[model samples]
Target: MGLLSKSRKASGDVIYNNEVKPQLVAKDGNIHIVMINSFSKLVNQNFGVESKYTEQIGSVINDLQQDGYEIVDIKFDSLKGQGITGTAEGFHTLIMYK
Candidate 1:
């Protein structure tokens, strides 16, 4: 088996706990964190349940702020239709530090 045989993709919480937390503990300076999520995959889906990417992102921001991180910037953008034939896709990004 490989070193990652039992490992999986880390969730936001995992990243915060294992990576961010350690850095914060070892350093007294500000720590920068950037998170990005795309909604294009769900844009034209027929799933009955509403997607909560936006809400989840907000929750992460709130949690980070509560943990002492300051919001540095926020950006939202959409990819315009390609060649005037493709549908536009949206994305959200957040930059925080400390």
Candidate 2:
């Protein structure tokens, strides 16, 4: 065990990280898409000005930064229906990493 080993995340952290982070990789390189919506909810939905996943998104960003990913830019979009699912209460966050 070394300095890096000491920084290793606990199993809970791993599980949470996996849940918050999308399985898709960056369209080009280190960029990633983060979806914050009711479908990702642990129980219910968040319809306030702030998102329920805001804090979780921050954690994911921190973890990505620790992995040598520099956040280049972030863009957000209000996501709507995909196919015929109808409107959704979620946001699409595009994160570019260097």
Candidate 3:
């Protein structure tokens, strides 16, 4: 890879290590974790539940699966002003267990 591209990849790695990876870790009991991912766009005039879900959280979920983590359940919510996404509309909660 070019020097600039390598630097960009390194920075992205740092970001994933610092941010995205932590969101998938267990909050308690070392068994399961609950993660919230937000979407700002809609698909096919609907929540685009599974597709959007797979698009946003797919890779991380795949990694977890390789490490023996399995998805227990997934839930969705449509809110206008709540949680970390004050005005965000589409959101999904992923529940995973090892």
lDDT of candidate 3 over 1-98, digit per residue (tens): 46744554454355445665676665444666666655543323454444433444554555556655666765566555544535545565555565
Count of clashing residue pairs in every prediction:
0, 0, 0
Residue 91 lDDT, candidate 2, scale 0-100: 57
**lDDT (CA) for every model shown?**
0.52, 0.51, 0.53
Query: Residue-wise lDDT of candidate 1 within 23-89, one digit each (tens)?
Result: 5532257656665654443354465532344444555566567787777777666554422336635
Any runs in candidate 2 off by more than 4 Å, and if so which?
1-51, 80-88
TM-score of each: 0.45, 0.47, 0.49
Clashing pairs in 1: none
Q: After superposition, how far is residue 94 of candidate 1 from its true place, in Å?
A: 3.3
Model 3 TM-score, 2 decimals: 0.49
RMSD of 1: 8.5
Off by over 4 Å in 3: 1-17, 23-30, 42-51, 80-88
List all candidate RMSDs to the true structure.
8.5, 9.1, 7.0
Among these predicted structures, which one has the highest lDDT?
3
TM-score of 2: 0.47
Residue 20: error of model 1 in Å?
7.0
Where does the lowest 10-residue lDDT sum fall in candidate 1?
A: 1-10
